[model samples]
Target chain A: MMNTKSLYQEVILDHNRKPRNYGVLDHPSHHAVGHNPLCGDRLDIALNLENGQINNIAFQGESCAICKASASMMTAAVKGKTRSDAETLIQEFREMAMGERDLNHPHHLGHLTVFSGIRDLPTRVKCAILPWHTLHAALNALSSVSTEADNDPVQNAASHPEALNRQANS
Target chain B: MVSANATLAKVTPRINTILDTDKIRADFPILDIKVGNKPLVYLDNAASSQMPQQVIDRLVRYQTAQHANINRAVHYLSEVATLEYEHARRRVQQFVNAQEDREIIFTSGTTDSINLVMHGYGRKFIEAGDEIILTTLEHHSNIVPWQMLAKEKGAVIRVVPINDAGELDIDAYEKLFNERTKFVSLIHVSNALGTINPVKQMIAYAHQQNVPVLIDGAQATPHMTVDVQDLDCDFYVFSAHKLCGPTGIGMLYGKAALLEAMQPYKGGGDMIASVTFEETTYADIPHKFEAGTPPIAAAIGFGAAIDYLCSVGMDQIAAYELDLLNYATEQINEIKGASIIGTAAHKTAVISFTLDGIHPHDIGTLLNEDGVAIRTGHHCAQPVMQRFNVPATSRASFAFYNNKTEVDALITGIRMVQKVFL
Candidate 1:
């Protein structure tokens, strides 16, 4: 059996209890609400992107521990990165969470290795990557992200494992 | 010799055949399986129930020997299948005490049953500016369909509020009915909170105002006997799977006169008497509502499930489950920071609860490690959660087959969850 303890490590709990950048943005250039209808977890991602870089990124919503932790880690990780670099970091993180990449050799996802054990718990894989997918939609300027969408980004993650791997290796 | 006599004395009180749960548990084979290393303690019966071997055997018998299309063939298998299907309808009629067998219309499940009434009755009779009375305790299945009809027909929906204890306010429900009231659809028992609504009195009041009432009995039929005749509800709906039958089959019990007044919900093969390119004449009562080749084997399995429940008796089941609920409530209340959501004066064998500082999902995950199954979410009744000021709840619902030992396991599992969070 895979270790559930690894999935809910101390760092994850810390991030959940005192989440970083956990509020609304005043006037954001990019914003999107992500919803998982299965558990009624709704997350709104808002960022002020200036000069092709994320000036500030914050999120506000109600979600489970995994989602809340992932969103907090995401905002802290991508706040100083350019939009293109942020997208690349998201791809790498997706590959790691999907177990397509080894945790020992993560490219740029620093503290996000706390979620590497998510792939073993299939149902919770959605919770772990919900905010990252929402970030992807926000960077693309889509108004919303939904598991119910016909072409959901979550589905894309499962369908395009090779793409995630290619982006991770690059 | 002395020890043997003492053992007999200890076991004498638990030997009542009316609620012979030890014997009843042996009938369900899946109950013996282990989840991890721990024995499986299934408390998610409200979401769906475990099937007994009798129902499984009946399904196998239908598929092995009695598989054929009904009403369209002259073959022996077709006739046998048709007889079994209609026999299942009669069984449902007797179970619910409906006036006639023809009044039982088989659909996919409870959601499908409500959607049929929305399309068949609401679309036909409900006009613009009319009012439909619904309660806050309704499952989304009952709420969404009416909201769609209200949106399309320009009709208005008046919601009856519930008290803090999750019981519907009877005075508020009476006031909601006015001259514009065309219909009322209410849940007989709340699936989320397990509060058995005062449906009989509500039905009587609706009858006085000359409004037809539909009762969503999906949560009620499994826990108690539902008599559509005694309640005098115009329509009653429930799913088979919630009562230890197969999925993809449910029955809608509507009064014959009201059923005849409504239009057919779907147009297809079995539902039509004759079909031409110009016009199609629909079939009689139940057939007009049930379109296409229905879930035949499932219907037979539903009959078998009803037989199984009748053998044990619903009243016995109700009594045993109430004892289980009280034991579990008392045990759970001992945990520090544990709070139960629904505290209605009257309820079935369901307990929705929350622990301080631990998310419901986290609690559910930890409980799964102990092989104790409970549902954690809004329970498909977001309105109930919202009204209770909770985002979600962990619900452990009981069935007749459940024992006191399982409730002890649940309490231990909840304590483990709290310990991890603490």
Candidate 2:
């Protein structure tokens, strides 16, 4: 008995129609790109950080309504949060996504809880996580001190994508 | 002793007209169902055609009455199974006008058939630096196998480009053929665009270079009568599901010489003469390729589908479908924002098009609201989409049972999409 209201809420459609921070960031502290090759979904995320906390964040890409709106919601949610607190929120989002965190537990999700209905549609989980996947990549990029001038094959190959995510929290 | 056109004209009148939809609809219980409380307008036939009652009945009949493994047992039911299975093979041979039943090897479906050739034939002859010519208008199934072969073997894939009418550029194709061109693998008809290639003449040309031509007849087999002898293609593959049969059954027809020359694609119980720890001698022709307990019921059901088609007649089906295609083109073209892609003169009833300013996803959603089904996105032909310079298009593919009423529904649905979006 899933209502269309929960699935296609006005707020969600509003964010989808007019996404926030929908473009690339230039020479930012952290930058990453995530692609959902199946549906041709892509997102480029950039972060401006100050003293181990997120100061400003932006994202831009072309994607389905769910993904585009999710990105808009995510950037709005994470702005001005400490890196550690943002990581906690990422966990909260993940828990909400997997249903490990109670979708009905009103306090845990905050304003980002519109995606509770998305958890029911497995195909849409990826769309909801588009921004998070890119954010993970951006977090990873932030912690790496390896320079482009080094041109180390192992370092370069290992530094991007998964390595970026691993370094974020570690 | 006549041109292909003349032969087509001569055979047109004698075409079998077996199925009238008003009666045929009763055979398929699914057609009677409702979507959003409206009649289901099933236009996704190219993706997979619906099965008729005879095929379903035959499958159930075999399982209940004569269920047994084939060519491996000596008991009564075994013999019955073996005879029926071989008889089905014979039917397929005649259906495709193949030279012999031995040339027909059953596989899981079209993808499996193509994989068999790519692994079996491509590994054998397509060595390093050799080339395989494929069309831009192929399904991912056709494109991937050759790409896999090319990557491993260091062979290159040469795509035959399409013209404005969505037909292959034959001039560019002629230029691609040379000594290093090991094979030309082409789709008999495009699943996405509905463009039918002239495989007969192309095969003739490729054969002159002593290069074998492999035709993917997955789309063609369902829409028209395919005579492998007439096409003179080195190999042809198509699935039964797209031709009113159940899934998990497909046929791979190759020239006897080519079949004999290529090694087996898979290895298991039925394909072997005797298996030793060291080595095994493979079984002969078709069985050599058919490695295990094949889709016995599905194969038999596919045979039944052939019987159904033969009764209805391919020429009559083709003629009737042409009428629908013309009608659909007329209707679809009338919409202001609607523009049909792949305007090739000769095409199946597949109409891929874009509505001005509206996302295909939106269009598909609105159509579904009206109980109409249509496919959206790249349709598994990304290269073709790249060629057309569009991200995706909404497609409505037709089959024998689809009629003018459905076309009207589609037009109305499209206009609704326009109204909602525009």
Candidate 3:
């Protein structure tokens, strides 16, 4: 039996109710809009990067509890981290949420693993990953990102390692 | 509130006498299945309905005893299959009260049926500058095909707007017709909102200008009685899956003359009088439109579904479903911060609603934990969503098999959703 109660823990509910870093950043270095056309979840991620480190990060969007909470936690986790480190966290979070990364294996995901429940719900995996996808788009200076299979930047990055390298260098 | 309760109490006994919902529910095996340690409360009939045992048995019987490629064979199985398939066509023709049996063409489903007309009729008759009238209440199946045709032929597409209650603006619909208007396509019942459009009146208005009208009856046929001849709609399309039958089979009921005049949408085996490398003459009305080998078994299952529905009278089903809708409406309205999206004067048993702070996706996910299956999203009617300034809505669409107990379960599930969010 899939435990939906485990999915909607107090942490998630609290985050959804009073999201942290829930605003647009002024004079942001990177910004991107994320849309999950499936559920009409839309998120705008804006971050200010100073000396290759994220000085500030914020998100404002209309999304489901899973998505809004994921966005809230993602901004808190990546702020003040180096761009490479933030990118590494994004990769790890995506792998964990997709059930590809075994929790027994080494990872830096920490409390972010609460979203692992999303793996059981195939329809909601995109909800948990949309914010991370938007972060990747923001880091690469892409204007927008979508969770739709054809337009997903994360899937595009995985299938083409060369594209990931190109995006990182750019 | 007391008077409302009184009205509900008075209506329930009359409805129960008309239709024994308990007996009807027993015919569906899926309604007995448990989901996540809870009994399934299916409220997503607007998307697709559950098949009764009769339809399922029909499919099994066809596959086991009488399965073969239909037409073009003198083999025993082939003849049986062809006869059964054509018999299914007659059942559908009678179900919708079409004038002729030859008028019904089996397509993949509602979307495919609309596309067939768009290709066969629109492509031939509609030229540049011709206007096609559609409404905000249309499903994407009804709207997108016309939009595609308009784009391809440089034809103008006019839209009739809806009021806040999601009813089509009748005056606006009437005004959309003009000398330039060549065709009108609209939804009979809104899948998302449950608003039953005055399609008969609208069809009559269009015919005054000689513009042919096609009613997308996908959502209407399952819930109410449909009389094609009485409405005098030139074309009507619906899917069998929504009527407790198998998927991948639906009917497109076009007037015989119009169907004969239109070009064939697809050309292949079984839809030809004779084939030549240079040119091929198409067969008569229905076969000309249904090219290639159709889903023969599913068609027979559709006929069985029709028989099953006829056994449980449409009037009885409509009255019972209306009571369920009313009871649900009264209950959901009592919940603060939960607003029903479409509150039209006349509707089927569909309730599209929104919670003040909760997304419909979250509502749907939480409701599933309680085995309450609903549809949540734009419902392929983004224009309607935009009209109401909502991105998406959580919809609970009821069928005749659903009882008030399931509606109560849905209400409880909604409260559970609210508690989790809180």
Candidate 4:
């Protein structure tokens, strides 16, 4: 059993109510769509990178609170960081969400560490990481021939049995 | 005074037709388990029903005592297993009131059954310029296969629209039929919305044009009485897992003539008559569709589930479930910022709703904390969700085992979710 209070922390509820960077970005350098077919959580993430650093980032679409807040905090965390630093932070966040890294010592995640509660609720791990996944796809679009945001990589992860069963049970 | 007694006589049977839900709950062991220190209030019956001890016992009995492949051997276990397997087929045949045992084709589940028909019938007869009519309430299982067939055969797909209350627009359905309309496939009940389509009338309408129809009864069988013969549908499909039986097993009931006319969906050991180097022949009706070694234990468990349902009586189960639905709907209606979707006049015990400010996934998660299990998603009926203009909805589907107390818990859970969001 997990503590519901920990899972739906006050920070999460506040961010969910008034999510930051919750709109589309115009003339974006990269964009990608993340979808959780199980719950129909769809988010379109757009990023503006200037000189190897994230100049601006925004997201749009409907999703659960965990997803929206993660997107909100992720935008605030990676706003001025280099693309490589942003990738490292996302990897760290993913590891924390999946219970792979020590959540008690989320040294560099800053406020993103609030999502560490996802380690206790396995079903929500995908929700917490969905924005990061879309961000990863957006970043990868920088080097790819096609700039169209393709989130098939994230869709495959969401459709995995472990994530699907968790969504089904919830 | 005499009139009052007559009214009492008329209503006494219904009032007295109480389901011993506590006893029924006892038969299902999972209901006893707690979720997060709270008693489990399972309301997701439309997704998959929990198995009863009788069905579990049947599976165990099959595995321990009658374990053998059917129709292949002459030994004692083989003979017993074959008889039991065939006996389960008959049980399903009788449960759906099919005309003959041969009309029942066992498949993996409802999806497999629909895919079988699409491959067997649609691929065989449906050609260019043909139109297949479907309703907006169909689950993806009923929709995607037809879409594939239409795309493959150059056939046109016509849709029947629905009203705001989630009732099928019968006028539009009747208007869609023409000389080009070759077939109709409609859901007997909307799994997401609980709208029970007028399938009998719809089938009759299709038959008037000499077009055949298939009925998706996945959500109907658990909550209502289904007479496939009475409905006169060309094909009917349902899953056992939705009726308190095991998964990986379901039945497809088609008219004998249609089944005989159609091609077999798969080719393998059991479905063949004689295999040669150059040519291979097919077996008879039910065996022709069943390609390989089927889920023997699950099939026997499905028979036990049917027996248990019969003992409870479908009418009594329907009545008790209606009571639960009504109570839950009324309680849910009282919640502020909560609106129920799909309010069809004719429906089963399903309520799909959305909170004003809360996403359905959040509602589902919060409800889980309170041990009230419900389904929240597009429910594999994205068209229906699109029609309702919601990405997803939280659905609380009732079964005969549920009581008013559980409905109250659901209402309380919804309020708690609202509190958290607000």
Cα TM-score per model:
0.90, 0.87, 0.93, 0.93
lDDT (Cα, tens digit) per residue for candidate 3, span A102-142: 98988889889888878888888999999999899899974
lDDT of 2 by residue, B315-398 (tens): 767766777787898899999988898999789889999887665755665577678888877888898888888778889999
Give the Cα-based TM-score of candidate 4 against the true structure: 0.93
| Chain B TM-scores of the candidates | 0.96, 0.96, 0.96, 0.97
User: DockQ for each of the predicted structures, in order?
Assistant: 0.34, 0.15, 0.60, 0.51
Q: What digit string (tens of lDDT, one per residue) describes model 1 on residues A1-170? A: 65674466564457877888886654567777788888778887778788989988778678888888888888989997899999998898889888899766638887777777778767777877889998998889644344344434344445656533422110
Q: By the lDDT metric, which is better: model 1 or model 2?
A: 1
Reference-based TM-score, model 3:
0.93
Which one wins by DockQ: 1 or 3?
Answer: 3
Which ranges in model 2 have alpha carbons more than 4 Å from their true place? Answer: A1-13, A84-103, A108-122, A140-170, B1-19, B36-38, B277-279, B419-422
- What C-alpha lDDT, on a 0 to 100 scale, does residue B395 get in candidate 2? 92
Candidate 2: CAPRI quality band: incorrect
Write candidate 3's Cα lDDT for B1-422 as tens digits.
24434544564555426467888999999999998789999999999999999999999999999999988799999999999998999999999999889999999999999999999999999999999999988898888888898899999999999999999999988887888999999999999999999999999989989999999999999988999999999999999999999999998999999999999999888889987899898899888988888999999999999999988877667777887898999999999889999999999999999998888998998898899999999999999999999999999999999998999999999988888777
Best of the candidates, lDDT? 3
Model 3 regions lying over 4 Å from their true place: A142-170, B1-16
lDDT of 1 by residue, B6-120 (tens): 4434545455343667778999999999987889999999999999999999999999999999887999999999999999999999999998999999999999999999999
In angstroms, the error of model 4 at A64 is 1.0
List residue ranges in candidate 4 displaced over 4 A: A104-106, A143-170, B1-17
What C-alpha lDDT, on a 0 to 100 scale, does residue B348 get in candidate 3?
95
lDDT of 2 by residue, A1-170 (tens): 23323355444446765676654433467767778876667776777777988877777666666777778888877878888777777778876766678765555457787776667656557867878878877787734322443322234435554433322110
